[model samples]
Target: DFQTWQLAMYCRKAKLKLTMKSILEEYKCGKVRLVTMLEESDDPVVKTVKPSIKTGRKWKVAEAIDEAKECLRLKEVIGQTQTDRKGLGSSSVKWWSKTEGKEKRDMVIEEVRQREDVRRIQKAVQQPQQGQWTNWDSAMQRSLTWKDIWQMAPLRIRFLIRSVYDLLPSNANLVRWGKKDDPTCPLCHGRQTTEHVLSSCKVALSQGRYTWRHNRVLQELASVISTAKGQSNPPSPSFTIFTTEGGARKWCWRSNTASNQRKGLLDGCDDWEVSADLPEWDEHPEVIRRTTLKPDIVIHSPSTQQVIMVELTVPYESRMEQAHTYKKEKYLDLT
Candidate 1:
């Protein structure tokens, strides 16, 4: 029935007419539908038969109109579905598609493999070193305190220990090398080494003669012995010397009264005089004599008169000048 109406509409719109029976035969064979023919038809009869239009055997004219509306709605829904699916597609897919060839993809994969290999090698190398243990703890365990380390150290290590200890001390007097000031020993003009500066320096030794002489005087007075035999007694009048250089030396001495007097003055007298500290007299006493002076050593006299003084040009320029001026002024004042 729907096909019959469709054919009738088509023939009318084309300004041609065929029998209704032929149209009915076309409908039975499912050839056409009311909406299609209506859209195509221009005939007045077909337009007037719109109320009788049939879309299919199941749909009347009214139902066919509703079915047409449903078809349009389905088309709109399908169009919307296609748009949404386009939106959900991966952005990467579009970007990749724009690429000219497979060359870029292969390059990216190769770079990733190289990076992974490098990381794997690095991890393998680091693992062993990270797990390895150092002998630091065992070495530390062998010595308790730093002093113990120094005491037990061999000759080579002792020097290192001394240097380390000197640096750690609050009053350490380490020399700054390569300074503009003179580096020679002021007393003897010898090259200044640490030992020479502090202890064994010939200049210092010369300056210290008076002090050593005084100490000899005291040793005689005190009746101290250098060593005792068959008495199980340790040596007396023993001395320890630490040089600025990395060595220490010990000395023991015994003196008689005559030897004491020859070295300086009376053994027990507190009024012992040396070349550096002799008081001015109206006439120079024959008993008092000048001694050699050096400027790099402190001669400690441990006699009744214990004396300690530096035997060097003072290190600081400003202070040395000031001291020189003061001494000159004092001498003039005395004169």
Candidate 2:
């Protein structure tokens, strides 16, 4: 019985059936030979022969069920992997063989799992925590606002915000990517970061780029203001001074622009020396140490005895509201 059962298993595995017809065919016993000897006197002894093989329909049914199960399993693997029967990256492979289903399934499952792991890791890296941005100091100011940034042409400020400039290889990016031997800023020997590249680095500040940029605009504004004052031509902004007689001041610019322009654009009537009061923060190192109230673009008018305070800020477009509010509140009393 066990042998018969094992034979049925073999048949099922090979997609064959064991039955009387198959057994007869296997043994070459299906046909009986008719002897043609002269039979009047002697008849050959008849040999007993019979088709004895018999099998139930259950084996065939069982075979069908096994095949159906294999098909269902392959289908499930294909669905989970979102792969064709031929597999991924194989243009000429048209289909999979049932005999190697397990191997193919394992390969595709591993590929899908690896792909999912990479996707999850990427998502985690791309989106950072919302709290990291809170209470953030750009090393520039605590009062930075979006409106302040939009007050000027956006391209340069946006460049700073994006940190896209060609920088020294010592920066954080190259260091993190293992391209650089150091993560310290070459300019200041500080940790190189976006903030350091833009704002926090002392060496970058020492380059006088910030002052140069601010003064370029200031020179243009001074020229325009001079024109409005009916001094169609004025001295170089570096040393030019407007004298309107008043006890109070309206505006004053204190900068290092006085180095080289003394002989180029001086005017006979342009005053180079006048009394001015700077905002507390900018007055002097001594002033900042003494007072906390500070203003930007301070103006002193001796003729009217009045002080005009102006505040300027640069922030991203998104922080315009905060920038405006901070400056307005800071100067509300003077306004």
What TM-score quantifies how close candidate 2 is to the native fold? 0.28
Model 1 spans > 4 angstroms off: 1-180, 209-335
lDDT of 2 by residue, 224-289 (tens): 543543442353354334556784544566556445335333232333222113222224223333
Error of 1 at 257 (Å): 39
Q: Output the worst ten-in-a-row residue range by lDDT, candidate 1.
A: 131-140
lDDT of 1 at 184: 62
Instruction: Mark the regions of model 2 whose C-alpha exceeds 4 Å error after superposition.
Output: 1-170, 220-296, 299-304, 312-335
Q: Which candidate leads in lDDT?
A: 2
Query: What lDDT would each prediction earn against the true structure?
Result: 0.36, 0.41
TM-score of each: 0.16, 0.28
